[model samples]
Target: MTAVRIEREIERKYDAAADFALPDLTGLPGALGEPEVQRLDATYFDTTDLRLAARGITLRRRTGGTDAGWHLKFPVGRGVKEEIRLPLGRAAKTVPKELAGLVRAYTRGRALRPIARIETTRTLRRLLDAQGNPLAEIADDAVTGQALDRTEPVAWHELEVELTAGEPGLLDLLDERVRAAGASPAGSGSKLLRLLDHR
Candidate 1:
C-alpha cells in the first residue's frame, strides 16, 4: 500500500488567448528561469451525476510530468485546496480503494468511473530568489478536454501560479502581471468542471 501525502495548495488560474505571452517578472523579488515543458494527460473519475464535482472536489489519475499519480483535491476556500496524492503503482482504469474510500462520503456507495479526459501541454517556469530557492511555479497550459457526454472536445489556454515558498504578496504581484498580459481570471474552478460543463 502506498502512503497518502496531503498538502495545502494555494494557486490562481487565468484564461488566456492562444497567442498570449508571459509577462516579464525577472525584476520582481526573484528572477524567472527558463521554461520547462511537459505533456500531461489526466483522466478524471466521478459518478455519472458528478457527485464529487458538485462539491468542488476532484479525483484524477494522471500520467506524465514530475508528479504522475492519483490526486484528490478538496476545496478549502477561494484559491485554496487540500490536495492528497498517491503513487501511480500499477493501477489503471480502476480507482484505488484507498482514494475511493476517501470520497465515500460524497459517493454514497455510487460507482466511480471516468468522466473526462484532459491533456495539457505545459510550459513551466520557476520563480527563484537570490539564493536559488524556488518561490513559485508559473504554468502556462494549453489544454484540450473531452467530456464523457460531449461529442467534440473543448480547448483553451490558461495560466496557473502555485505558491511554493513565497509570501502572499507574491501571488498578488503575479496576478497584476498576468492580468496586464491580457489573461483574465479563469471562469471555471477546474479543467474537469469546465469540460463537464458543471456550471
Candidate 2:
C-alpha cells in the first residue's frame, strides 16, 4: 500500500533542562490537553557518504507512538516536507520493496543501511480551539541516539511545538513562549541529522 502526505510541520526545537517546565499553553486557541506520553524508537537508513542527508531526504523505520511504520520524508520547501508511509507487516530490518523503489533515484544502485538510531521519550500536549478542534501539539522529548557502526551513544533533550490544525502564526506565538521558558533554538535538520552529526 502507498500513502502520501503533504506535511507542513512548522516547529521549533530547544535545549531542554532536566526539570523543564512547559510554558502555559492555555492562552492558545482553546486550551492544552493533559499530557500524553509515549516512547519512540526510530532507525534511519541512508547511503554511505550520506547522499540522502545531503539532499534533505530521510528514510526511517520507527516503532511506537501514534504512527509506527516506515516513513520516507523528502523536503518539498521551507518548513514543509512530503512524507510517504508504508506499513510494517512481515518486514524486519530490511527496507520494504515498495518504499525502497520510491527512492531509487537517490540510492542509484547504492545500498541503504541503518545510519542512526534515536530513541525518544515524548510528552505530547494537544492544543485545541474552543470548538474542541486540534490547533497544535507541544512535544517535549528526551532523546538518546546511537549511530550505526559507531560505539558512542549521544543523549540530549529537546522541545518541539508543531502546528497541527492551527494557523501558522500559532507557532510564532508558541515559539515566543518556549523561548521565555528557556529553550534555545535547535540548528539541526532533524533528530536523525542531529544524531549523526555528533559522530
Candidate 3:
C-alpha cells in the first residue's frame, strides 16, 4: 500500500444555512433558467454508528458521468468542504485502504460498510463574468435518501454553489444573487454528508 501524506483535521458544525444559486456553463446565452435539465444518480457509503450521526463522514463508490469514483469529503467551512476522489476499483464494498487511513482519527480501526444511499437529481446553472470565465456553478437539487439501518427514505430540495478558481470576491457576488433568488443555504457540509445521512 502506498502511504500518502494525509492531512487530518476535525470540522465543527454551525447553525448558519442558505439557498445556493449561481450560473450554468452548459447554458451560456440561455442560462440555466431557459430550459430545465436534470442529472440523476445514487451515492453509496459506509460509516460507524456515532460517526454517521455526528461527524458525517461518507465512504462510497459512485458511478455516473465524468466523476465516477470513490469520494471522501471532510467538512471545511460554511458551504465548503474539501473533496477527494479516487478511481473506482474492484473493492466496491470496502473503503479504499488508502482512504481508510485518512479517516483513521474518526474510525479508530472500526470496520465500515454501506450504511446509507442517496439519490439526487440536479438542475445545473453556470455563472460567468463579462470576460466569459466561469465564476461559479449553481445546482438546484432534489434529493431522496435511504438509511440502511433504519430503512427510512427522506426527500428534500436545496441549492449548491461551487466557485471557480479565481478571486474570492466572485463567490461573494454570486452569494448575493443566490440569496436574492429566495434560496436558503442547506447544512451538512458537502454532498458526502447528504449521502451519509441517507444511510
Best by lDDT: 1
lDDT of 1: 0.91
List the global CA lDDT of all models.
0.91, 0.83, 0.58
Please report the candidate that would top TM-score against the real structure: 1
Angstrom error of the Cα, residue 45, model 2: value is 0.7
TM agreement with the true structure for every prediction: 0.97, 0.92, 0.72
Alpha-carbon lDDT of model 2: 0.83
TM-score of model 1 vs. true structure: 0.97
lDDT by residue (tens digit), candidate 1, 20-129: 99988856778888899999999999999999999989999999999999999999999999999998878678999999999999999999999899999999999998
User: What global local distance difference test value does model 3 have?
Assistant: 0.58
RMSD (Å) per prediction: 1.3, 1.7, 5.7
Ranking by TM-score: 1, 2, 3
Q: What's the ranking of the predictions by lDDT, best on top?
A: 1, 2, 3
Q: Candidate 3 residues 1-199, lDDT tens each?
A: 5323333322222212234333323423222333245655545555556463366555667765456677776666554556667877777688887787778788776777776676777666555566666555566677777767665677777766566544566556655555655555556665546545455
Give stretches of model 2 more than 4 Å off: 2-6
Query: Over the stretch 1-199, how does candidate 2's per-residue lDDT look in tens digits?
Result: 4554445556666777867899876556768888999999998998888889888888999999998888888887666677778776566578888778988888898988888898999999988887877888889999999988799999988988777788889888888888888887886768888887888
The residue pairs found clashing in candidate 1 are none
